[model samples]
Structures are given as C-alpha cells and as structure tokens.
Target: MCRLALKTANEPFSPYEVLQAMEAMKEGYDGSGLGLLLRGMEFEDFKYNPRFPILSGIAHSRKAEQRMDEYMDDRGYELKYDHRFAMNPEKMSGKMRYRYFLRAYRMPPAFKDRPQEEREEEMLRTRLDLRRIGEENNGDLTVFSFYPDVAMIKEVGWPMEIGEALCLWDGQIKSRVCMAQGRQNTNYGINLYACHPFFIQGIATMTNGENTAFVPIRDWLLGKNIPGYIGYQSDSEVFAHILHYTLRQLKLPLQAYKHIITPLSSRELETHPQGDFLRGLREVCRRLIIDGPNAVIGTLPDETCMLVMDQKKMRPATVGGRDGAWAIASELCGVDAMVPDRDPAFDFQPMREHTVIIPPDRKELQIWSQHDQLPLPQAA
Candidate 1:
C-alpha cells in the first residue's frame, strides 16, 4: 500500500495535494481503496463554529439520513452546519450506494458547561452508538470520524480518482495536516472500514505493510476495556489505537511510541540511560510490539506528524520539506512530488532506529533515535 502525509506549518493545504503525492507513488499501490484524514481544517463553517465536533462519513439512503437527524435531535445536538458533497455520479459509479457528509453539531445543552474530558467521553459514546446502528442496518450510515477540527473520507478507487469523485479538488475542506493512503487490498476484502489512515480520538495513522502480530495486539487493546477500541476491520487500525492508548490512555510522550512498538534489544538497552524503565515497559507492552514488515505515518492531536518503521525496516519511507511545509510518504517519489524544491540534503529516510517527527510549528524536523533519549541531527 502507498501512504502519504502533508503538514503545513501555517497555511492550510488542500487534501488534493496529498492525493497528488500518493498518485505519484502509484507503483506501490493497486488502487483498491483511498483514505484521507484531514486535521486542523479550514472550512468556512468550521471557521465560524470552530468548537463544534464534525461528524463525517456516508449516508446510504434517505432513511439513513433521517435516522441520523432524529438521533442527533433526540440527543439535543443542534445542527449548526450540514455540508454534503455533491458526488459526481459519472465519476463515482452511477450506482454508488452512499452520499458523503460532513456535519457539524453543537453539543447537547447539558454538555455546554461540562469539562472537556466529560464532553469528549459523551462524543465517543455517541460515535460508537451511531457506528453500531450503521452496522446493524447494513451500513445505512457510517461515521468515519467525529471530532473537532478533523474530517475523514474513504472509498474504493484510485487515490486521485476518489478525490475527484468526492469533489475534494474544489478545496472546500483544507487542513494544516492531511494524510492520504492509496490502499493495496491484501487480506481485507475491499471493505471501506478496512481502509488505512485509521483514527481514534484525535490521533490518526496509516500503515504500508502487514501486521503479522495483529491478533494479539487487537486482543490486548480490546482487553483494555476502552470505549472506542472495537473496530478491527483493518490490521493497521491497531496502530492508531495503539497511539491513542499510549498517549491518551497511558499518558506517555510521543517519543515513547517508537520505544513501545520497536523496543531496543537487551544488549542495546544495557547501554541506555533508561534501560530499567525500558525493560519494564517492554515487558508490559510486549503484545503491542509490531511484527512483520511495516511503516507507519501518523498525526497527533496537536498536528504533529510522525513516521516510523518496523524493526525490519523493509518498507520504503521518506521525509522532506522546507520551512513552512513538510511531508512523509512510503516512497521517495511521493515526497519528491509534494516538495520538489526541498533541499535533497535535508530530506532523509528514517531507519528502524529513528522516528522522523515534525511538530505543528514546523520550526524543526526532528529525527529522534530509538536507541537514545536525545534527538539526532535535525533539519535547519
């Protein structure tokens, strides 16, 4: 599968640009599916109602649409803005079963003054309830993401073709950080839910290789008894969940993710300063250790974008950009397409021992080493 992520330090960029990057790496994907996750959005409605949570997905029928409206109304959610993409029937098969939607809703009256944590909990419950309803009704309605400043769209088609079908090139929903994946159907049977760039809470991730250790990782996540840890349609979904679990649930730093997923060997740990802590964490998170060939690209809540590789480092990945924009992709060609004028000397491929992390500020491109707590040389 091909994966690409773009993050602008200041100005919001179009998700179409990310699709362009993925399109450049067409050799790595078979065009089975395309998934896009846009965060820190700049839509007109969002600018006015920046605090409202956006519920994005597809409604398969008029009945499904009505059901969603009724459900939200019953829950006291005020519909602030309802924007539906006018899909091109000719571009997106005439028989397409669903219409894309990005609806922003004001919170229930009672949640208006509630703590942020409490409000977030209720939103998660609402999203899960809607998801369950969709599943029960044969996917009459499907919600990909329900959070503030985030929106997702996915379908089965070539990355750029799907973008055109969704009318994303119109540039209505631009974002500071956007991630797109051109999927190569392997074992998932071409399900939309199985598409990459999976998200949970505010964290999102897309992967390029198989997760041979998916079953155990999924089991461990489910065993955590988290409210939103139910979907396992894609093996790579676990990566996003793991990120949420590590950062939100476990309250660990972002750097700890590389350590948790690909911990240092015993001999290497021996020479490390936090060897004891690393040892304990390795044991505790053994099941979460990713096995098999894989490369991950993800974005945190703060719009910090990161790229990490499995211990084997089998998949191709690269990071490149200038002062205001940076991008990570599964291949050098993808990065080249995103930022063609970037200095080749600054563009680097992260190894199994490092994580390429670019904060929202875009002031520095940090290459963090898994073997040490300190950061390696950074882009100037």
Candidate 2:
C-alpha cells in the first residue's frame, strides 16, 4: 500500500483533500487514472515546478554551444573564432582569409579614399561588433536574445536536487560512512526519504552477492506477515526491519537502544556487484551472527582483519571490546598515532601481503583495487 503526504501552498487544501482529488481522478479514468490525473494537473498552478531538476551547468553550456554551432552550420557560416565572435585568421588560410577580408573591408570610397589595407582594417573593426551581436543571438527565435534563465538553472538549480538525491541514496551504505560524513552539511538532510528499503536493497546488491538478507525484510512487511502494531505498513516498515536485522547481525546486544543505532553507514553498502568492502562487511556480519562473536577468525577468507584500538577505553592489547572495536578503520599514520600496529595477533597486514581478487564483472570493481580477490575458474 502506498501512503502519500502532500504539502500544498494553501492551508485549506489539506493533504486529505489532495488524496480525495486523486481518488476522484482515479475513478474517472479507471486503469489510466494516474496519467489522466497528471494530464489534468499539468496546466494547473502549482508552487513546485514539474520538471526534473537540472544536474549540470556544464551540460547546459555544452547544449547551448551545440545549438549555436548547428545554427551556424545550417546557415553555411563557419565558426572561425572564440565565443566572443572574432574572426580567426588561422581557420581561414590565404585564399579564404583574403576573400573574407574583401567582403568585410570593401566599403564606399566616397567616405574617404583610404588605402586598401587601412580601409580593410577599419571595415573589419566596424563589422566585429555587428558579428558579435549576430553570433550571440544566433539560433534564438524567442523575443529574449539569450537564455539567461537556462544558464542560471544550470549554474544554481540543477546540482541542488541531483546532489541531494545522490547524497541521500549514498550516505546510508555502511562502507560510505566516511564519504557520507563529509556530505553531512549539504544534501545529507534528504537522507530521511533516501534511506528507504528500495534504496537499501539496491545498495546491498551493488557489490558481489545478491542481497538475500534484505529479501526477508521486504517479505516481512509486504508478504501478509506484518505485525499489527505497525500502524502504517509500507516500504518504511521494510526499512525498519532491515535496520533491525543489520544491528542484530552486528551483535549489538542492546535491544532497548535498537532505534538509536540501526541504520548502516553508506560505506558498508555494496552497490557494485563486486564491491569488496560491501562483500567483506556482509561476510563478516554473517559469520559473526552464524558462529557467535568469537567466530571472527577464519570467517574472512584471504583477508586480514584489523582490530580497532578503543581510545576511549584505553585498552592496549584486546581484539574486541566496544560495538565498533573489531571493525576495520583507516591505517595508522604517525608514530604517535593511537591505532595499533599491524601484527599477526590482530590479523592485520598490508596490501602487498594479500592476493587481490578481480570479479568477472568489471563494473563491480572498486575505485581502489586494494580489496579485490581474484576468483578461481570453475571446472567444466
């Protein structure tokens, strides 16, 4: 079931009123309801623009340039200069340049009997301004000579929605934790709607394996097994289930605090079919849950796990302690850095010691191939 909340410009048109209007439209058109409703509302005055937000200012600039070039090409006019509309001598060699110079420079000799060269130079200068105006207004059929609004849409409007959607969709993955943190001040606020089950499952399947764990979560909500307490059962309930499952898999023992620490980080999400980080995290979590907390060893095949040193607890030699103690973080840098040194006890090793795996699908490869493990070919 779909539950929609509408925010209208006026208070009198409540969300329920919008829903009723939608229902009426649906009744009027039968199966073609949504399309008919949209058609009816297409010309209505709405606060929000119906168009999808533009994503790149460069795209707009490129499109404008293409249109201008096409217009010039159709008119048999060669674009021989920069955006400012000045003629380029390089593009027009000896004969072409001379012809163009004659056309541009030749003027009535009655004004002043100037030398051919000097008159040509003066005429060229006079035509430069007019040529600039013509170039600037090329391909423009509207009363407004240039699409300044298009430029503004590209420069300011496009990136806003696109970036917001990106940040929202990407920030919830467990592996993208660092990147998501970096985007917290900007489009991250849209994480509310972006962290839905559809997005989560999409991220999970992005790496190496099918998102089997998320399937159950989806089933629990929409497959006639939903709990009565869930007032509005929808995709959001699936999100809650997956969040709970992730926390449980992580072995975070606090049931009361489930709400506080359920959502996985964007870093942990495996969107690519062969993303090692996603696969590794999933495997680690699966192993931990299956074999109990002590089964961290031998779970990650061909991978060296790092034991994070808890700075707050000030523990020096322990492998596991806090919630995120066993998880791998960035490598230690300075001599005085708090992170533990790579040792056999902690199962930590540099990339040089490990054999990297490359999945058959090229798109699943990580940005950095540090975690890739080459799979052996199956027997025929």
Candidate 3:
C-alpha cells in the first residue's frame, strides 16, 4: 500500500527547501522505498501561486533519482515493481530502481539558439550606436518603448498610468514653448509619440549642417525642480541644464528659429498645462499669418510640411509655398494641401526622393532642377 502525507505550513517551500526535505527523507531508506515515496506524494499539496508548486515538484523528482543511484551503488541491487504498489523484494533490486527513476525524471531539452551572452553583446552594440547618433546630433532624439501590436497593455502588463502622466506633463511643457515662440511665424508644434511599426517622427530636428537639436522651451521646463510623476521628474532641472549646455556647445542659430515639442496621447490629445499651452500656441499662429508677411516661420520638418498643406494658401503648380505657408508646414502633407487643383500635372513628391527647383535669378522665370538619386544601402 502507498502511504502519502501532506505537510500543512503557512510558509511556502522553495525548490531548494523541497530538495532538502527529500534528501532528509532518503537518509534511512534504500532504493526500494525512495521511488515509492516520490510517486506517492500528492503534488497538489505544495501548490502555491507563482513559484512553490512547479519548482518543488522538479526538485522532489531530482532528489528521488539521486537517492536511488546512491542505494544501487551501496547494495549492488536490482529493483523491479508492478505499475501499482506491488514491490516484490526478491525480484526488485537497487539497480532496477535507479534505472526506473532515471527514466521517469529525465532532464529537459537544451535551447538551440545563440547563447544569452552573445545576444546581450549584440544588444549592447546597438545601444552604443544609438547613443553615438544622439550625441552626434547634439542630444536631440526620441526614445520609444516598442511592443508587438497584438500585445495589449493590460494583458502584457505595463505602468500605463505612470506613462500617461509623464507624457501629458511633457506635452504641457511643449505647448507653452510653442506659444512663447510664435507658432505661425515659427512653425512650431508638438510631435506624436512613435508607437507604430515605422520610424518615430518629430522627436528632434537635424539641421542643414547635420547638427541635431530639440525644442528649447520644453528642455528648459524639464530642468526645473518640480514635483511630478515622470521617471526623470527628480532630474527635471538637470534636463534643462543639459539642453543649455548642448546648445552652447553647438553654437546654433537659435535666434532665427522657433520650435515646439508636444507629446500626443496615443492618437488623441491629453489635458494638462501642456494642453493650455497648445491652445495659446494656436492663437499665436492665427495672429502671425494675419499680420506678418516677411516673418521667417521655422518648424520641425514634419510640422512645417503639415502646416503648409493643411492651413496655408498656395499658388497653383508651385512646388513650394510662400514664406508663411511653408514656414509652418514643410512636409508633403502641407505642400499637397497648399497647391491648387487646376494643374493636374503638378505633383509634389518627397523633397528627398525627387529633384527640387532652384531659381537661377530673381528676374529669370525658368528654374534649374536636378535629381540627386542615391540607392538605399543594403541592410546588414
């Protein structure tokens, strides 16, 4: 007959603890009894959330096989038994018991892919490249947390509330900067968080000279000693300090440019101090176009394009819009919206992909155009 005893304890058993317990039980018994002890234990008794049950069972199984091996070595016995509790002492020997236990508790298969150390080294190299790019571009860049599309926040688990709070606060700071800079003339706006499969847009701007920069106003607020829930809230003031230091180092032409950096919540806008700032920014944009004609509107590449096509008036068949229109929006979306429908032949392709018209002289009506095409390098 099989004898099973379930231990009741408030504290859960770890895998090591379970292995120790099994070892203690094996001290008195030979191979004949050790296998029975293992098979008889009610695995359900050790079950607990997270860790206890699964690991303990694994430990118990390993301990049983080890004890059987020790018994076989000492006694030089071969063990035999029926499927149930029929242990014939004459037919069953220690050697047979060891073999039986070995078969029952085989080790799991090994992983086939690259070693973890190699994978980690690869990841480290990639991160280094990212850091170098950011540094070369004057610390202007966006970092995003990427996840699979099928993965839900609740199902996969994430700190959604905390993330939203930080994003909203960031947005507020950006909107304020946009308002102060004059949106219409400066072409400043916020960028949406890059959450899609494509590249992240509107994090930082790479200047014509290849130097990178972010919105100054948002960087300034991040440097203030303020109570907030963002991850870097404690070092907010440091962020601003870094921005100033970087700008000074780069010797950028800040006086000629206005920029804003707003954060969008998923697809929609979030409410916060930043939201109010964006409202003020919109008002500024409305006023600038109404009053100023020669003002140089500067915006991030994407926003500049968006504003030109969506909000400004443009001449028919013109590849580029007037100063005010292109100042705010300078992307394909902006350019497409500005051009009149009468010229079906006039199509606006990507500035980088196609040739741009360069006027030879202020008097000459004919424009010189050339396409500088370069093939994309093969990915490594």
Candidate 4:
C-alpha cells in the first residue's frame, strides 16, 4: 500500500509541509516515486498571472524541449512563464535523471471569454491531447496538467531525497490545497504517470490500497467518449474518472458518487431507508461498484475534499487539523505533522463504511455512513 497525506487551508498553504509529513513516514514505502498536485496555488511570480494554465512536466531530451515550446505556441498557448527546477545535484547525483519544467500558458485566443465550463472542457481536452502526443512520441514529454489554479510537481526518488532535490524540504510551493503520495505498488511498472494523486478536469484522487475491481472499472471507463479517460496508467486513475463522469457527465450530486462506486448491497438496500432510489441506481450503475479494502482521499472542483474507507477499512486513514487547516493521511502521524498542535476535540479517525467531507479551508468535517444514507423520499 502507498502512503498519502493532504493539507488544505483557508489561506495560502505550502505542499512542502505535506512532503515533510510523507518523509516522517518514509518507512512505509520504497519511495520509487512521488506525485504532488496543488490547487489554489502560490508562487512568487504566478501570483499575478492567476488566469493562465500552469503546465508542469519533464522534457526527456533537448529535442523534447524544443517540441514542447513549439507545440504550445503553434496551439496558440502563449508561454507566460517557463521555469526549470533547481535540483540539489549533490543529493541526486548518480540517480536516474528526469528534467522538470513548469510553463504557464495563456489560453488560446479563441477560448477567451467563453463560458467557464466550456473553457475548462477545452483546456482539459488540450492537456489530454498533449499527453497522448507525448506517449506516441516515445515519452519525450510528459504534460502533467493544464488548468488554472492547479500546479503539479512529480519526481522519481525517495520521499526525503525528492523533497530535498526539489527544495521542498524548505517549502518552495504553496496552495490552498496540496496532496503528496509515496507511490508503493507491488503490481505495476514504476511509471511516473502511474503515481498517485491522479488528476483530470479539476478532480483528483489518491488511494492507499489495491483496486480489485480495476479491470472492470477501466473497461467501462474506456467505453465512455471522454478524452481524458485514456491514461489509465494506474488502476486507481479510474476513481478520478468515475468521479468526473458521475458529477460532470451525469450531473449527479456529490453523495451520489459514494453510492455509485460503493453502492449499498442488495440485502442492505432492501431494508434501507433510501431503498427505492438506491435500488434503481444499483440496477443502472452496478458496473461502477468498487470492490476493495481501499481508502480513497480526493478533492472536488469546488475545493471540497473527501476521505472514504471501504466497508472493511483494511487501509488506515486519520484526520487532524486546526481552525483554518485540515489534513487526512494514511496515518495520524502524517496528520500530526500538518497541524502539530491541534485542538484535541477536532482530531479523530473515521470508522469503516464512512465518508468525510472537508472543505478547502478544512473549517468543518462532515461524516456520512455508506449504508446509512437514506435515499430521497419518492414523490407521489
């Protein structure tokens, strides 16, 4: 199982802190890779350029570097900021080298003033197209994400070394929300894109256990006419796509996702207070059911984050935070690292079959039981 730690606050928050938490619990993962996604991002220069899409990834060679610049320009994305990372070479010498670059781009002129939703859809498709090009061109480029207010930083190394190499140990990036995952998967290749904290169209998720139902989930998602669904490098990526489908495509409520992915059982539904509606949903969307002992933590486009445990709660997750900040991690130790001196009254671990909704500021924590959610009463 991998380890995940998330920190979100009302004010500017640094993801470097989350990396520090992962470092404290480094013993759990081999540290083959690390993935970080930050929303409501903060950087000295990026502060003034809030509307541009921040594209961050690796350029494997000089040719790849030239291609990236050309692709962005030819596509009408004005390159506003291009910053290469400064790695601590002393710490990374002799290690497999991956060059990191962050480029902020103004949307193509045609996209300006379009409805917010349409612009988001356009940028998302563009990002996916760029990633596909990278894949087809032999991995010369890896475009992480192209969205406003979100920035991605990923690397292959032990948590501590990766943090140090990127100077995260001293906190160089800040955001209202940030998540870091110590990728430890026994079943997959060590691909960087396969790392946790998977993202698509503003929805992101990272899990801490195996997804036994991954095959069926991926098969179903691939059938959907969605562009961003192509990169299922990690089985867990479906969790993020399924979320996008449910909330964006189908236009369902947030809680409805819990039912679709981990719906109530037939036996339980028969007696469930929300029986009638639950039965209908199960009949229509049973393929979305996820069978697992996994714990999933994710963030919504609205800046709300969620922590959910499978009925078994086989994987561990803890909750902690103070008035302005909130955190959820595979272990409480990580949470403790975020809000070191928290109010004891606000700290607690969620039980099995539970879901916790934490806002961007993490000002309040809401818990819902899977089997206990009563469907809306049917009208006459």
Please write out the lDDT profile of model 2 over residues 232-275, one tens digit for every residue: 21222233333334433343312211111121234533454335
Per-residue CA lDDT of model 1 for 94-149, tens digit only, reads 35656788888899999999998898888888898898889899888988988888
Clashes of each: 0, 27, 21, 1
TM-score of each: 0.95, 0.17, 0.16, 0.94
Q: What is the C-alpha lDDT of each candidate?
A: 0.83, 0.21, 0.21, 0.80
Q: By the TM-score metric, which is better: model 3 or model 4?
A: 4
Candidate 2 clash total?
27
Over 4 Å off, model 3: 1-218, 221-380
lDDT against true structure, model 1: 0.83
Q: C-alpha displacement of 300 in model 1, angstroms?
A: 1.1
Rank all candidate structures by their TM-score, best first, as comma-separated numbers: 1, 4, 2, 3
Q: Please give the lDDT score for candidate 3.
A: 0.21
Best by lDDT: 1
Global lDDT of model 4: 0.80
Better of 1 and 3 by lDDT: 1
